[model samples]
Target: MPVTARHLIIQGRVQGVFYRNWAVALARDLSLSGWVRNRRDASVEMWVEGAAEAIEQFIAQAHEGPPAARVLRVIAQPVETEGFVGFEKRPTA
Candidate 1:
């Protein structure tokens, strides 16, 4: 499977909703490596690197978030993988 990287910005009802933690669990389940953090602008940002299919699946799950999240939009773009070691929740940026 070919590896791919993507930067995703999830908007709306994300912060304070355990969205980052949810992402960490999902990413780990998918065996993806990267990080997720809360943006100052009230969005959740993530950089995920993994098999293309897995990344796609991650994105799909991200849209629903932790049941408390009311995801408004998810913007994803291709990025260069930094060979991240594991999925993690990062401090807000």
Candidate 2:
């Protein structure tokens, strides 16, 4: 499987709703490496690295985050690398 990375900006009702924790669990379930953090702009930012298919799955699931979250938009961009060992929840940015 080809490995790839993506930087995703998930906006709208993504903070304080267990979004970060949900992301970590989802990434781990997919056997991916990356980090998810909250932005000052009230959006969630994630950098994920793993099999191309897994990354795509992660993005798709992120669009429908935890029940409390109301995901408005998901902006995903190709990234070179995130240098992560395992999925983690990062400090708010």
Candidate 3:
């Protein structure tokens, strides 16, 4: 079944990388709804709502990130629902 999930990706060497944009592309391709952003601590965060399988695939991709990114870890948790219109790159927070 489809569900919502929040993922905090500790992207090693993620700064100056296009991790957020890559996440947006993957999310949109998976038909997921949510947003992705970079953290001040050099991590990438995202929330996705869609099929369980799709979300899982997205999470796996996050672990590998972009070609320039070296993902260290991924923390995933379920959410109540999708709280965004579409996949987007949000401002750092």
Return the top candidate by TM-score. 1
Q: Candidate 2: what lDDT? A: 0.94
Instruction: Please give each candidate's TM-score.
Output: 0.97, 0.96, 0.88
Q: Candidates 1 and 3: which is better by TM-score?
A: 1
Tens digit of per-residue lDDT, candidate 3, span 4-88? 5665555577767888888888889998988887788887777788878988888887888889888778888877784667788
Of candidate 1, the 10-residue stretch with the lowest lDDT total is 83-92
lDDT of each: 0.95, 0.94, 0.79
Q: Over the stretch 41-79, how does candidate 1's per-residue lDDT look in tens digits?
A: 999999999999999999999889998999999999999
Which regions in candidate 3 have their CA more than 4 angstroms from the true location? Answer: none
What is candidate 3's CA lDDT for residue 74?
A: 85
Residue 88 displacement in candidate 3 (angstroms): 0.8
Kindly indicate the candidate among 1 and 2 with the higher lDDT: 1
Candidate 1 residue-wise lDDT at 27: 96
